[model samples]
Target: MFENLSERLEKSFKLLKGESKITELNIAETLKDIRRALLDADVNYKTAKTFTETVKQKAMGQNVLNAVKPGEMMVKLVHDELAVLMGGTSTDINLKGSPSIILIAGLQGSGKTTFTGKLANLLKTKRSKNPLLVAGDVYRPAAINQLQVLGEQIGTTVYTEEGCKDPVKLAKDGIAVAKKGAHDVVIIDTAGRLAIDEQMMEEISAVKKAVNPDEILFVVDSMTGQDAVNTAKEFNDRLDFDGVVLTKLDGDTRGGAALSIRSVVDKPIKFVGTGEKMEALDVFHPNRMADRILGMGDIVSLVERAQEQYDEEEARKLQKKIAKNQFNFDDFLKQIQQIKKMGNLKDLAAMIPGMGKMLKNIDFDDDAFKGIEAIIRSMTPAEREQPSIIDGSRKKRIAAGSGTTIQEVNRLIKQFDDTRKVMKMMTTGNKMGKMMGKMPIGKRR
Candidate 1:
């Protein structure tokens, strides 16, 4: 996501490479480079100009010490400015009021329906809200069905009225059903026009008036760049949307929309659609986004992903097995499965601090453990428990059973042995324990 814009921004920063002090001349050169980068990313020219000018003034005002290198100082200054441009802090979706209603609006094919599903999934799974997805797209049966499919996938209930031409009524009826069903959160996914039209705008406005929703979220396709911001402004003018949802961010978006939408629409970007997966919705974070655009990795998000997958009782059992030197390939495979549950491998890899920079050009797969998994699955129960007992003859048999080579089977045993050794040291040496023990701490304690 935004890889192209990230690349362009990185190129701009090279103007200060090997520079000593932040001279006005070199700074101006770098500023021009940054402006060009933003323009290339499809940022509006005026917004791009104002941004660089503000960045330039701030860069010059900073008290640069001899210890601070020009390049490093410029990076830091740009990061600060970028954060401001993207909204300085993450904003939460306002789920206030009993049966809080959040109305989703956007142009057709802007990923409005997909975002609605993702948002419902996020609220139900992460926020622990009993969310009912209200399908208001009466024009397309497929649209209502799409929301239902996603609702099923996320284990959330969807409310829809078939042949209900009046969406305002559909939404109202959906909420009434939700109330009876004991749902606390109601997300109304409204029908979208091919483009902004009088009929569609009025329809959405009517729904907004009828529901008086707690949050009116404008979802826009980030790949549309400046147009996304412009459309957001139009929607905000009509609905007075509470927040923005930048969708299709997982696509080849140039990063212009995320940077410019908030400033243009005067609304906080509350969430981002990082992928098509229901779990891909992320609460917008300005600082982390800045780091990502600058080719710096986001360790905060990486740790959050890890914490999301951490189960204390499970961890305790695994630790005991490790300490007793009984940690087998099955445990290793289960650990991998738990990590996979957190998120996409590519997305998780991007969150690792500095890993994105190192891996920008490489094609990394989430199934990096596939070969290991196949080999382990082919192993007999005894071999799984005692990998050391698998001799060369056993290796050839496992390889044939798993449809892998004998060398691959041998490599898996060696790697498994090495992993157990590391785990034993981590469990007994108190290194891993100290780290896990110092977590935010369980509230029950």
Candidate 2:
């Protein structure tokens, strides 16, 4: 995500290293570096200036504790300020209206249609709401087709008129359909242009007035930098959107749009598109984001993602199996599937404290687990249940079936055996059971 900005900010914080306490001269030097780092990250000039000044004011006002180092204190101040700069906290989308209607608006190529599908998937999977997607991009036939494909992929209903050119009418009709179908949420995906135009603005405004949507989200490509902020301002002036959606955020290293859009439009960022999958959307959390940006990791968000895939009954069964030293390849395969469902592998790893910097030069494929899954799947049910019985000849056969080498099979078996021993130990003293009890799983937010 904000790889470059993170690196820059870390270096700026190093200016206070070894300092016994804060001082005007030392703080000025650190603030200068911080300001330059923000500018290099494509942050708005005005926003950056205001942010540094506010951070400075707070830094100077702090009564540094004898136990806290100057570098540690400065980092804390900057981290809190960064969180405040990104809207201070997360904001939930309004869905109080019966068959709550949401309007999606943005410039073309901003991932509006994809975000629509992702939002529907989140509502359906996480919130337990029946959502209907409306293809309101009447100017583009391809958009309608795209929406249909996404709707099919996510198992949601999509409303569309074959040849209708009026988006306002499509949205109204779509809402009526939602009410008839007893859907709890209706998301209308509006059309976008290559650039801002009067017709685009007026058409979206008309739809907003007609539907009186409970929420209007402005999607923007985070990689567009300051241009994204400027475009958001223009849209807010016309539509007064309820929240902002930063798309392609996983691909944006500078993070200018995510940092500046809130300050420019004064709208909380509701969601961020982390990847291409329908499950890749995440509720925006400013404090967690600040943690990630400052190399502190976001353990809370990471645990929440794990909790989403955690099944209490399944975990209980798995615990019993492990207690009896019965954890097998089939069990291991299921665990991998649950982890894969959590989201991108690299993104999940980055949530661990200090892993972001360690993984800076490494490339993580989303399919990193494919080889292990294939190897496990190639095993016979007997072999999966009792891996210790596999001999040399069986290893050759399994390796050939899995398109892997015998050495790979040997490595996997060794790793599995080692893991089983550790799990057995955890279960021996009821340690694993106690940890599971402490986890806040199966709880509604």
Candidate 3:
């Protein structure tokens, strides 16, 4: 998302290359470039100035270790400052009340409804909370229906009073229903106007007072740049929200709002909406985000996503199968499904250090596994369990069923067999030489 800023920052560091230390004389132009990069990214002018100034101070005061290059030292200082500029640490949403009331407030097109559903999914899956979604956006037609659709997708309950025009009353009543249903979390999605207005402000403010939410989150569209910051300020003045939620971050966002909102409103960003999926909500981590912005990649977050999809019991079972050389196409298909659950293919690849730069020009299609999955699905159950049983005629039949060439089917079988052999050798701790000897030597005929 900060692709332009990352490139600019990289170039700025290059200005300090070949320098022995970060002296004022040598660092001035570098700092200027950094500030310009921030401004071009749509960061608030004052924030950009303060950030660069603080970074310059830190860079100048630090001792340059012989082991570390001057450019590398400057990068470290800027990364730390960027983290501080973006709230210094991640904040968790408050879910401490009897039924934690989370009121979502934002502009009409800011993705409030979608975020509500995502938040519920997060609580249900990660936090183990029974969340009840309340469709309180009565002013927007079909808003309630949209939330209901999301609720259904996440398997959460949506509490809506059809024909009830009073959002404040609806919110209050929704909380009551949550109490009766023993729902531990109540997320109330409120109405928003095209722009901030007296009626919109007063209405949400009244609803806040009525419900006394445990957490009031102002969702903003990150693509709006500085306008998002201004809207956050106005909302904070009235609602005094607990934290901010930046949505549509995966879109064509300049990333100014994310880098500026916390500083402008003096609030932590609790979460960010990365994509359209209900599982796309991520708890904001400032240091990790700083890493991503600097093109350093976010390995910690990548591992966490992998852990979320990891099943210990399943791993044990799979290990046993691999040890016995029984890692067939069905097992391979399950592994692909686990990877797919981790998120976007390109995004996942970007999490690995250095992969982002390598894939910067590559268009990673999300459906890259479609062909493999289709081929596997085309197999008969018996063939899936016993892939070796497939012969020449079976290959032709599978190719036609999967809409692929017979050669493609043979290639997949060859790949699967080679993968199984490699995995078996690794699990068995076979010597490197022996493993290489056991590897398949030629292409499938």
Compared with the true structure, all predictions reach lDDT values of 0.85, 0.92, 0.91
Give me the candidate number with maximum lDDT. Answer: 2
What tens-digit string does per-residue lDDT give for candidate 2 at 141-164? 888999999999999999998888
Which of the predicted structures, 1 or 2, would earn the higher TM-score when compared with the native? 2
Ranking by TM-score: 3, 2, 1
Model 3 residue 442 CA deviation (Å) reads 33
Model 2: clashing residue pairs? none
TM-scores, in order shown? 0.91, 0.94, 0.95
What tens-digit string does per-residue lDDT give for candidate 3 at 1-445?
Answer: 8888888999999999898877999999999999999999999999999999898878878888999999999889999998999999999988889999999999988999999999999999998999999999887768889998999998999998878999998999999999999999999998876445888788888999999999999999999999999989988998899999999888778899999998999999999998888888899999999999899999999999999989999999999999887878889999999888788888888888778888878888888999999999999998999999999999999999999999999999999998888899788775766766776888323
> Top TM-score: which candidate number?
3
Error of model 2, residue 281, in angstroms: 1.2
Q: Which ten residues in a row have the lowest lDDT in candidate 1?
A: 436-445
Residue 252, model 3: lDDT of 72
After superposition on all CA atoms, what RMSD does each candidate show versus the true structure?
5.6, 5.4, 4.3
User: How well does model 2 score by local distance difference test?
Assistant: 0.92
Q: Give the Å error, residue 171, model 1.
A: 0.7
